[model samples]
Target: MNRSNTTALTQPGAPMKVRNVSKRFGAFTALDDVSLDVAAGELVCLLGPSGCGKTTLLRCIAGLERQDSGVLYLGDRDVSDLAPQARDYGILFQSYALFPNLSVEANIAYGLAGSNRDVVRKRVGEMLDLVGLSGSEKKFPGQLSGGQQQRVALARALAPAPSLLLLDEPMSALDARVREHLCTELRQLQRQLGITTLMVTHNQDEAMLMADRIAVMNNGKVEQYATPQDIYDKPATPFVAEFVGQGNWLPFQRSSDSHANVGGMSMRLAAGAGQAASGRLFCRPEAISVNPLLHEENLFPARVREITFLGNRCRMSFELNQLPGHALTAEVGSQDLPRLGAQDIFVALPPESLQVFA
Candidate 1:
């Protein structure tokens, strides 16, 4: 959608403040003193595995579920005690929740009741055009494809031009290709309208692709919150390091702030590597080079244990000679497989790539 058109249809976004929100059910705690702030016009994703309180937190914000203790504010208005309908936000569910009996136009115009009929009709048409479903106005939800139904639901949520948008796994039901396409479209639309949005998803790729910032939750608390790259490269916790992406963890004994012993082989640590007496060193598989250049340091010998072809790249498993029974895997280009003959291979682990955590 065009910028001018989007601005004309939607109101300026508002910031949402959440302070020390806590929720519980009987003996179980769903949210544990969680706090977050969503800036105006920013898109943030609550990301974690299932049952991690991401959904519970989103529902709390929407008033679908109330928090036992916390303060919620949309801009300057305190909305902590307001009912769902009384809050200034619109929500799109994973199921789309479109009225199956109603036509596309009717669904989009549902929130426009009590207004001028002509104005509602015009607004519905504009929403349909904005979501690229203008020609399907007469079609029922059941008649349209999954993607189309989702578009209709999105149109409906945007029809009233709410200041905040809440999406709860909105694309999970669609196929992979369709879900990816919709993610891109949704991000573009959100940016064009400058709507403050909060989304809940367990999919790492989805959060990384769409969110301006991500809050990684674990066991009813936010473990870390930062941009996608920051979360991946400099995770604040070991769980965040392992959960967000693939990494190799090798047990190490620290001898000093700048040195550690991995499998009895002494290696220099990266600058600013925490002063842990002993811990595991974390490094991404891609950071380990199969064959070392002459200038590379920390070269170690390992034997290829197995090889698996994965379309464009090959995954090779290696047994580190110094650390028997321990294995490491690396992603290598398919074309370079021949260079790795039937013999021991040397791998280089760059110091800067290693992160030591106690």
Candidate 2:
């Protein structure tokens, strides 16, 4: 949680801008002309798979690592060459990085080292309240749960009331259930306080759930940067489309900018799609309709290869007769399964639902 009702810890957020930044270590490139604009009070996630350079970019912004080239800005200030201690932002690492020997009070007050003792105590109390850990100030990191330790780290990061907040895999240490709850809480608090934040995460769900926008990275370069819905629905690259979520991909030859041929089956594509050439047609499983009556002409015979029930929903795996050997999955509500009892069915993949990448 990043919000605060106490004026002592609340401050207006500052925008962050990274302009044509690049970093490299030896022969390995870590960031490639990366650029991003994070508006004031917005949460942006640097999302990608492991070793994709998301962390490296975060480190460069935090001044933990020096960038080989390019500029960085926090609001109107150029902080490209500033060291970590001199930067006007607080970072929470994946490890929590809390001092095991220090009490929660001390850990959170570490950032206020030179402040008056009374002021430090008041700020620590305000931070503890902000994170919903008010009464646990005397507890050591080892004496608290994983989630609590994370809050202490968060409180420490926010204690300085920095205009920009940086998060590096902040919830990776918690169990799934706790991570989910804390994420929601943290997001609410971040919005409540209106703090600008940059988060680095490999988990797609976390990024999708909390980010106002996301920068999808791969191989030390930004693949696509946009809102989660835009990134998911209109991915700019094959890497972005494949990395963001589960989808059915089939090799096909484009008939034109608006049509594609998968095997002998004709599939409509988005207008102004890829060039007329061989490419892959992509569609998310959730976008596929199972035997819709309205799209009868586009429907194809399919056999249910498997059906997995997941509480409120079901994931149906299908083998389309027209595109055999291609993986096809459709996610439907559990209550809607009564109509899908038959092993055989007709499936529809609307033209507007597909992405063609040549």
Specify the highest-TM-score model's number.
1
**Model 2, range 1-358, lDDT digits (tens) per residue?**
4354544465878999999989889998889899999999999999999988999999999999999999999989999988788888989999999989999999999999999999999889889998889889888999999998988898999999999999999999889999999999988888888889999999999999999999999999999999999999989999998899988888898776666778888877767555648878788999888978575445789999999999999999998997777768999889889977699988888777877787
> TM-score of model 2 relative to the true fold?
0.95
Against the correct fold, how does model 1 do in TM-score? 0.97
Count clashing residue pairs per candidate: 0, 0
lDDT of 1: 0.90
The window of 10 residues in a row where model 2 has the poorest summed lDDT is 1-10
User: Clash pairs of candidate 2?
Assistant: none
lDDT of each: 0.90, 0.89
